[model samples]
Target: MDNGSFALMQQLEQLYIDHHSWLSSLLRRKLSNSSDAADLAHDVYLNLIRKGGVPSAENCRRHLTQIAKGMVIDLYRRRRLEAIHLEALREQPEPLVPSEEVRALAVEALSHVDAALRNQPSKARQALLMHKLSGMGHRDIAAELKVSVSSVEKYIASGLRACTPYAVKRRPFR
Candidate 1:
């Protein structure tokens, strides 16, 4: 590795050594589950590595806290979605349910979609959901939202753009 990469790795190693336990303890308190806390602590490091930042010693705790907080929120959202999906399945009259693998994939996709929509404006997210989930046309969405067709189109486009990164990342290799 080059000088910069070496330095970054060294910094990350030190940061992990210094803060992993503290972070894990914090997460344990917040999540009240040791396994989940450990997993999230590892995830926080992975996120930091992916971000390629060598956080300063003085600010590292705060930075790590922010990243961990976001991860915790994401974890909660995923669990909530899973609970809802299970409840819906239970409500169905038929004994049939999706296979475990299929359900896992669906939940993963739903989580990505939920994350993508989290940053969007309410109207934009609603328009996108109406178009994609409800199978509404642009004009129909506009009517429902009390906006023009052009506005609805823009909102859908924006939401799609936000979600495009996740879709692209998951595409199969040729």
Candidate 2:
């Protein structure tokens, strides 16, 4: 259609062809895996596709570099989350055969909290959900649940202690 838009697309395409390998090589040196770095470099192009159009070639290189960097940070976050989940799973009583069992454990934990809420009359269960499932801070949960900050802390601590026995226990040391 327009020369400006056409030029922009061409610039991004050429940038991908020229510097994608360079980006992967640099990212691989910094990260643990070359494939992951290549994937991130590829994601930068996919994101531009989603945005309807890429910027002019003059800016596309810089923008691609920025996008690649952000993707690296995102990968780190995902890795951290996976570590936390795996650590938690190791101490739980859930099934180990199927991969879906881990998701089931998360579901069961939420269900236990829900049942406790229905059983309790006051702010305890609500506080538990806010602190555990909703990711609220102690002070924030207290404010939302109309309890003291100390009470919120107590609720979370007690809940965790109460669930520890029910949690998945690790196997004996070899």
Name the best candidate (by TM-score).
Answer: 1
Best by lDDT: 1
**How would you encode candidate 2's per-residue C-alpha lDDT over 61-80 as one tens digit per residue?**
67777878877776675566
Measured with C-alpha atoms, the lDDT of residue 5 in candidate 1 is 86
What is candidate 2's TM-score against the reference? 0.51
Give one digit per residue, the lDDT tens place, for model 1 in 22-123. Answer: 999999999999999999999999998888997888999999999999999989988999899888877777656666776677678778879889879999
Provide the clash count, candidate 2: 4
- Provide the TM-score for each candidate, comma-separated: 0.73, 0.51
Deviation in Å, model 2, residue 122 alpha carbon: 33
List lDDT for all candidates, in order: 0.90, 0.70
Output the worst ten-in-a-row residue range by lDDT, candidate 2: 110-119
